[model samples]
Every structure is written in structure tokens, then in C-alpha cells.
Target: MLETLGRSLDSAIRKIRRLPQIDKDAINALIQDLQRALLSSDVKVELVFKMTENIKKEAMNTTLQKAKRKDFIIKLVHDELIKTLGGKKAPIRIKPGKKNIILLVGIQGSGKTTTIGKLSQFYKSKGYKVAAVTTDTYRPGAYEQLVQLTKQIGVKCYGNPKEKNAIKIGVQETKKAMNDGNELIIVDTAGRHKEEKELMKEMAVLEQKLKPNEVCLVIDGSIGQQAYNQAEVFAKTTSLGSIIVTKLDGTAKGGGALSACVAANIGIRFIGIGEKIDEFEEFEPTTFIGTILGIPDLEGLVQRVQEAEVMPDPETVKRMMRGKFTLEDLYQQLKSIKKVGKFKQILAMMGGGNIPDALKDDAEKNIEKWRVVLDSMTAEEKESPNLIKKSRKRRIAIGSGTDYAVINKMLDQFRQMKKMMKRFTQMRQKGKGGMPGMPGMGKGAEQFMKKMSKDFKF
Candidate 1:
């Protein structure tokens, strides 16, 4: 969704790279490129102007050292873009051992109920006893939807389909969830704006009665320019303490929604990247801008690895780094990577670049094919891949429903991986930590490691 804007921003950086020196003409051209990108992404004209002015002022005032002028200018532009997106990240402050009442508000069709499920799962994984309360009496099946969502995430939900009062339901649910040892209670409210003025008034009264710890406005990213008006309206009704932008993975106006929130002076607490409950992520302005500017979020990738339960323990990694690994271990690692997600997505995150969807799909298919071949291997063959002779390869290929050449290809890859790991171990022992250029490590691994260490601490 933000790919178009990403390309434009990258192009602006390219303009700077082509310059022989940082001069007034080059700065103007870069600013103009930035302006066009932001405006095309539906950012407010006033906000874009202010952002470009700030960038130009800072770039012109700062004198650069000769050795790394290009890098310094790129970093300057990156920092300024982050500032336009909210300056810094503001995470939700959940109170421990007490009910953290988070009231969700937005207009209809903003994916509020689904977001509640995602939020519950996110907190649940963090060891919080989470619960959901639905006060959305205006929407049919709202209560049932929350009930099912809570069930799926193993969180208790409170709602009464017969109840007509939103405030009463909220109050009752809060007490019930609190008594049941729920540390977090997420309240889902109705978003009916049939009578705009009346709806806002009702919401204000509900806010007064509930006095939630946080009032979060869920904005649909697909709404584009209307996001600002929606957020402003909701903010006026209640204290819209934070924002969560959803449906960012689609061809939505994600750039528009994010920039609109910034212009409205609302801090974004989270963003929904996909429909899955696990696809939600906390909003960080700098990291987000970095990703859009072709800088991958290595930390975020590590987090996802942990979340997917695919990251090996420190001991396993240590052993592998020391060159003690077999085909069995290689198969296990492959399984873990498969569990992490689509190969292309992970690769993109590692490199801080985008991959074509077609290529991603093709890579996924190859991974599955390799998994089949691995499955066909015997226990001994897995532990000692050298035992797989031509006859054994044919047998395994028949079992895996693939050609003998495919099995041979898989074995070759396994051998290459072992070789690469040995090289990695040797390099580390020699105190050459980075992957750098190495025989059998391949250009892909070298490129990946280079991009990873660009901003990664370890």
C-alpha cells in the first residue's frame, strides 16, 4: 500500500546520490521530489510544506564532512520524514494488576471488532489476562462477533444482545471482567453516525460515564483523505488518546491514513498490516520511515521470528555458528523458516527492499517442494546426507513425487549450506564477524548480511 510512496522517497534519495556535491540546486530538487510524493500520498498541503521547509532549512544549515556527505544527507532526509509521521513512537501503557480500560471508537466499517481481536491476541501473548467487552448495540451480530473472537484467543468476553444501553453494558462488563482476574479489558463501542451530532453527544456521555484509561480511534486506511476528518470528529467527542490504522496490507491509502493522523496531532499506537490476528504491530515512526525508505527493520524481523516460535534458542545458534550441524538440523531450520512465513516476505524484511509478488509465490512453491523431499528422507539419511547415493536419491524422489534431479538439487543445497556454515564459523573464529565476501557463502548471503548489519547492533 505504501509502495508508491516508498518508490518516490527512494527516488528522492537517488537524486541526492547523483549529485557531485551538496549544493542549493540539489537540495531544491530533492525537496521538490519529496513534496510531490507526500502530496500524491494525500498528505495535507500545509503539513507537507512545513515538512519540506524544515528539511531544506536543516540540510542547508548543516555543513557536511567530505568522507560521507551522501550518507549524512540521506540520514537527514530519513529523520525529517520520520518527524512528519509523528516524531516518535508512543506505545500503549497497560497498567499491571489492574483493569486497563481501552475504549475503541470509530465510524462503521473501520474494522473495529476485528482489531479488538488482534489487540487481545497481542496482549495475551505478552502474558496479560485479556478480555473483550462489546457495547456496540447498534450493529447486529456485534456481540456475537466479539464473543467468537474472544473464544478464539482464549479471552473472556462480556456482552448482552438484549441490552440496549451502551453505557450500561460497558459498566457491567468492566465489573465482571475485573472480578474474573482480567488485567486488560478492551471495550468495543458502536460507530453509528446516522445523526452525526447526536452520535457524538452520545459518545461523549459514554466516555464521561466509563472514564476509560485510553480512548483509541480505529481508522480505516482505505478512507484516504477522510481519515483526518474522522479522527478530528472522534477526538472532539471523546479524548481520542491514540490511533490504530487498519487494512494497511491492502491497496488502501495507508500513507494517507498515517499522514492524516499526524496532521491531526494524534499519536498512532498500533497498525494492522494484515487481516490475521498476529499481523498487528506497534507503530514506530522512525522504523516505519526507514522501511519505506528501503531500510529493513531487522529488530522487527527478529520480533516476528520470536512471535512465530521459529527462532532457535541461543544454544542452538551457538552450536550452528561453531559448525556443528547435520542434515537433520538443516531440515529443522528449514521447518522453522517455513513456520516464520513466506520466504519472500522474510527476505524483504532482511534486505529492507520489496520483492515482486510473483517471485514470492514462486519461492514459496520451491520451499514446499524442498519440504517434501526432506520428508521423504530416512532418519539415517537425514543425519548423514552423504549416505544418499544415486539409488537412494531415486527412491526418495519417487517417495516425494518429484524428479530425481529435484532430489539431487536438494542435496546440493544442503551441502552448500553446510559449507557456508563452516565458512561462517571460520570467519567468526578469525574475528571477522561480518559475512563479507566468502567462498560458498554466495552473493545472496553476503548481500543479506550487509543489509542486516547496516543498522543492526549485533
Candidate 2:
């Protein structure tokens, strides 16, 4: 996301880190570079200038010496970026033991239907009994589309494809969801464009009749400067609790859409990173800016991992600790990584520094190839990778229709991975009263998340 802007900002920060001294000229040059990057990414000229002005004033006023000055400047820029993107708004959360209704509104092609599906899966994965109610009676197949999307993730959806009255469907479906024991109900409305008066009227009607716990505006990330107008128009019709920006994946206008939406006086609650249902995530401005500046967002990474349920289970952890790691386990690990996100995306969250594009692509391809090769192997061979000797490798390669070298590389990687896991196991065992066992993790995990959200250093 915002790859161009991120690369530009990362380069400037790395340059500062490498520089022996950051004089006045260096600071001015950095500001100029920031302006250029923001402009190139389609950020509103006014917001960019204001952010730079704040950064300049703070950096110039800092009394720190050379070493500390650089740190101060980086932090100043990070904080300013966050402030511009709506700093630290209260997170949108479901009230326990209460029925939560979220109404989503947006213009045509804004990805409202898909986002509702994603939100359903997102909340469902977190243990919420989620259901989606489709009030989009105008759009052809809108209800069916939502049903198909939500069905893949096992989210219940209620809609009347034949119903012309959207408010009726919304009211009835929502009541049905509440009666069905659903904790979270996400309502999808008809997409309204600038010239569509009737649909816009329908939106206000649905909002009034449904009385959603929260009304959310879904804006396309590539809408750029127009996002401001769209957000404002939607706000006038219905009070927005938050905004959800879609199609941010690799979009240059993502920056513009974000700043423009926030400028409309509404905080962004979530961002769509890609087309996948699981790619949508909560928007944290501090972590976002820190990521752009190459800061490691461990909390964000952990959240994704948790959402994906990628953590090793107790049985698997015990097996690894007992040196029972095998190709099957490695295959499962690769699958978990895929579920979490793309390799490059994961790298970004972990502060991946200057990795060559070729390597990133190759790594992604290798994972796909690894999965294929592992699939070709028998259950016995996967359990005992040692059983697959030279002859077995060639046979498996032919069976998978992949190069023999791929299998060789995979085996070598597995060996190195196993060794690393062994070392970590030893280190853990050696510690007196070491890291908490996986079994006792959930008791305080919620409290831990709360504390981290407040005190987490982005």
C-alpha cells in the first residue's frame, strides 16, 4: 500500500540515518523531497504543505544535538503524518453482549459489497457471530454477490433479491439477525453516485429506519481528491461513525483518498489492502506512518497473525520442541503465511529493508512451488522428510512437474529452518520460568491488546 510514497519516505529516512550530520540544508532538502513525494502520490497540495510546515517548525525548534536531532526529526515527521491522517481516534469495537449494527454507504464501484463481506469475515474470525444484511435492491445481483462472498467464509447473509423496498429488507433482515443470535450485523446499502438522487434518498431512509449503531462510508482509495466531496456528501445525508477506504492496494491515489477523507472530519476505521476478503484491516495512523518510514509495526503484524490464526497450536509447538518438525509442518507454515498476506506485505509490516524486488518475487513464487512439491509427496514422506532421498526427489519433481532444483532448495531451506527452530527451542527451555506456555495465552491476551494499543510505540 502506498508503495511509491513509502519508498520515497523510506529513502529519505535512510539517507538521514547514513548522514554524519543533519544541517539546515539537509533539513530543507528533506522537506522538498517530502513535498515531491506527496505530490507524486496525489496528496492534496494544502494538506502536504501543512504537514511539512508543522514538521519544519518542530524540527527547527528542537534543542537536541546532532545524534538526537535526527531521531527528533524522524519522530516529528511520523507524528505529523499521523496527525494529518486523523491521529489516534477511538477504535470501532463491538459492545459485548449487545447487538451491533454497522451500515455501509458509498457510491457505485466503491466496493461496498465486497467490503461488507470482508468485514463480516474479519469480525467472524475474532469470535463474533457475524451476519450481513443486503439492502442493495437496485444493483443487479448485489444480494447474490454478497451471499456468495460471505458464504465462502461461512458468514450468514440476509437479503431479498426481489424486494424493491431496501428499507424493508434492512429492517426485516436486521431483526432476523438479532433473533438468530448474531452479535454483529453489517448492512449493505445501494451504491450512490454523484448524479444519483434516488439512491442517495434511499440511503437516508435506510439510515433512519435501521438506526444503525454506526454508519460507515466506504470510499474507493483511488477516488483521490474527489473522495473529499463524496465523503462530505455522504456525511450530509447520514452521520458517519467512520470511513472505510477500499482498493488501497498499490494505488497511487490511496494517499490522496486517505487525506481527503480525513479532511472531511471523519476518522478512517478500516483500509482495504487487496481484493481478498482477509486483506481488509483496521487503519492505525501511527503504525501506518511508522511503516512508511520503515518502522517495525510488531503490533500490527501480531494482529494480522491473530486474525489469520497463524500462531502454532499447543500440539504443534510441542512437536517442534520435540524435534518432530517435518515437511508437513513446513507446508502448514507456508499455508499460514499465505493466509496472513503476501510475502511483500508481511515484509513491510516487519520493516523489511531494501529487499531486492527480484528476491521478493522469487520468494513468493518459491512458496507456491513449495506447496506444489509438498502436495506431490506422500503423507509418509511428509511426516519423515528424511525418507525422501535423491531418487525420491527426482520422482517427486517429475510428479509435481517442477524442476528438481526446486525440491533441493526446499529441502535445504527446511533443514536450515529446523535448525533455527531447534536453537529457539533450546533457548526457551534454558530460560528460568521462560516464556508463557501457549496454553495459558488467552487469559490475559485481551488486556495485553488494550495496553499495547495505548502504549504501543509505532
Clashes of each: 1, 0
Model 2 CA RMSD to the hidden true structure, in angstroms: 20.1
* Regions of model 2 farther than 4 Å from truth: 193-195, 297-458
C-alpha lDDT score of every prediction, in listed order: 0.75, 0.76
TM-score of 1: 0.62
Residue pairs with clashing backbones, model 1: 296-352
Please write out the lDDT profile of model 2 over residues 126-220, one tens digit for every residue: 88898999988777888889989999999889988887888889999899999999888999988853457777788888888887888999998
Q: What is candidate 1's lDDT per residue for 46-157, written digit by digit as tens?
A: 8789888988897777533332456656776776777777765556788899768888988888889999999999888999889999989898999998898879889888
Which number leads on TM-score? 2
TM-score of every candidate: 0.62, 0.63
RMSD of each: 17.0, 20.1
**TM-score of model 2 (CA atoms):** 0.63
